[model samples]
Target: MSNVKDTTKANNQLIYAKRNMWTGILFGFGIVAFIDEAVFHQLLHWHHFYDKSTTEIGLVSDGLFHAFSFFATIGSSFLLADLHRRHAFWLKRWIGGIFLGAGVFQLYDGIIQHKLMRLHQIRYHVDVFPYDLVWNITAVIMIVIGIVLLYRTQS
Candidate 1:
């Protein structure tokens, strides 16, 4: 009986941890996407989500990207609320997940989108090396922070 009870408790903890981590990931991704769209695309006019075409198409692409971010944020908020209601929220784990997700998203944007896919550069009329270096390094730092926190294994 004692062993069975212990197993069940451990399983529950695992489930809670996973839930918290995933919720944080979703939230982090959405927030980063929103920031990229608003700051780089709209405010600075550096580049659009898809800049392979005319300005009008780029604006439309930005709109779609914004919508995706909005939905991700909203969905993650609901999941987080559910976790809170169930008394399963884990703060440290959630934060770790956030950093992990943000780092992954940023890295993807910097490498795949900016380089491989040729979606857009960080800036149009500037040397791009510095921008790329800073972006990737920042992403790596966030990923390290997230890994450390997530692996601490303490509630």
Candidate 2:
């Protein structure tokens, strides 16, 4: 019974060590979503969330996307706050997690939304292949960096 308890405690400690990375991933995802909306959708006016729909619908879609991302950011903040309270926060792992999350989000948008769903491309009136190529490749690179950082994080 003591051995079993020891194993359980060890497992919990291991999980705690990786918690920052996971939380950072969540924060990264939300931040990327916000940046996407700000840059592509609003700032550049390259494309809306759903270009196939009416303009008003497209605006609404963007709003919903913002709301979702906002909620994700908020949720991650709560978890991070708890970790901070416990003095378990590890900044490096958290940042790596953010990178992982952002990379994953970008990759998904580039692959699934851009290629698979046939949604709006990166930008209109542009040579899409280069944009797609660059976008996915960059995302992969970011993900690799994130993986390396998280793996090398001190326990």
lDDT of 2: 0.85
Candidate 1 off by > 4 Å: 1-13
Error of 2 at 59 (Å): 0.7
**lDDT per residue as tens, model 2, 53-145:** 788998998999889789889989998988776666777788889989999999999999887896778888878899889889988988998
Please count the clashing residue pairs in each candidate, in the order shown. Answer: 0, 2
lDDT for position 154 in model 1: 52
Per-residue alpha-carbon lDDT of candidate 1 for residues 1-155, written as tens digits (9 for 90 to 100): 99986676555556789888888889889988999999989999999999999999999999999998999899989998898776667778889888988898999999999999999999988999999999999989988998898898455
lDDT of each: 0.88, 0.85
